[model samples]
Target: MGLGPLEIGLIILAILLLFGYKKLPDASRSLGRSLRIFKGEMKGMKDDDVRSKDAVSTTPVRGEIVPPPAPSGDPNAQLQEEARLAELRAADLRARADQARSSDSSR
Candidate 1:
């Protein structure tokens, strides 16, 4: 048979007795925070999935010969490569920031 109101109340009373009234609020707050973080991460994963799909669509087919990155030994050439990579990173950050701003504004 299913539990009635009295049974449910007794179960709740047992829980309160086990955990105490003071600890319940702290435990619930911790649970809420954990759920919030979990939801945010799940949202981030969905966004990553969309980004990966876009990347896959744009990517070249299998068997294509992709060129390797620049050599590491030469100091001047390494500096130039580093500079180029830094610029690329800056551009990517700016683009993402802009996208975030636009999404925020739209929302």
Candidate 2:
């Protein structure tokens, strides 16, 4: 059931005949690009899975209101608070982007 070297060679020959030598490089380049994009998307999905797991692990239970820490007058405390807020904003943006991408893909 497996293709031997001769069969494989014939397939390659057929492809070459269908697409001349001048076009072969372009075809291969496109194939490589497609493969790279596919790999990147797979990696993104894995990252999303890990991120979801981490979020789940750190999330507060239902009916809980985890308020931000009380404001401290210290400058360092303010900077830290700002940094945390920035991270939250960035996460929100990423979620939106992911949603958009999913919707686009569905279409």
Candidate 3:
């Protein structure tokens, strides 16, 4: 039969009588500590589940058939920017070469 409050109280009283008042408090304190530890473990498990659910819902990998949007500044723009930078570098190198050659000729 399911225990009502009266039945539960009697069981608790019996336990207290068996263990004595001095030991009952200590036993209850240990039980409270165990319950707190169990609650903490359950919370951690729930947090991990939420994290995995969020990861699955967000962000895509490379090979998915439904491709992610191309990033801003397309390849053509990047290539043109790279070419411009190359030209600037080449010009700088040419100027340096000319200065060296002129210095040698003057000497």
Candidate 4:
């Protein structure tokens, strides 16, 4: 019925003839190694599931969706203040240069 006995024997004979006896052992060993690797990968996935279950969320405010806290002071405003100070220093230097030139010409 399902490939009787004679057909099964013929199929075995064909497989043996196509891939000799020694080659069959080697092929089976490599197939076994591949199966072992597949089993290890499945076990690794189970380990990952366990790790995820054990992990804790790190946020202090876990439930609140608050906007980020504002900076203590604005950086742009501080930078503008520094720029104004630098401009005043440059104007003072230019005035000093003009006075020195005037005194030198008079002398």
lDDT of 1 at 90: 56
Instruction: Give the alpha-carbon lDDT of every model.
Output: 0.76, 0.79, 0.73, 0.70
- Give the range of the ten consecutive residues with the poorest summed lDDT in model 4: 55-64
Please provide, for model 3 over 1-107, each residue's C-alpha lDDT reduced to its tens digit, 9 standing for 90 to 100. Answer: 88899999999899988999899889999999999999999999999889856744453322233334447758887677556655655565577669989999999
Off by over 4 Å in 4: 1-3, 56-107
Give lDDT tens digits, candidate 4, residues 1-107. 47899999999999899999879999899999999999999999999777644532222222434333345689787677556655655565577669989999999
| Tens-digit lDDT track of model 1 for 1-107 | 99999999999999899999999999999999999999999999999989966754444334343334566677888777657655655565577679999999999
User: Highest lDDT: which candidate?
Assistant: 2
lDDT of 4: 0.70
Question: Model 1, residue 61: displacement in angstroms?
Answer: 8.0
Ranking by TM-score: 2, 1, 3, 4
Better of 1 and 3 by lDDT: 1
Residue pairs of candidate 2 with colliding backbone atoms? none
Instruction: Pick out the ten consecutive residues of candidate 1 with the lowest summed lDDT.
Output: 59-68
Ranking by lDDT: 2, 1, 3, 4
lDDT of model 3, residue 98: 100
Candidate number of the best TM-score? 2
lDDT by residue (tens digit), candidate 2, 1-107: 99999999999999989999999999999999999999999999999989977864465434344456566668887778657665765576587679999999999
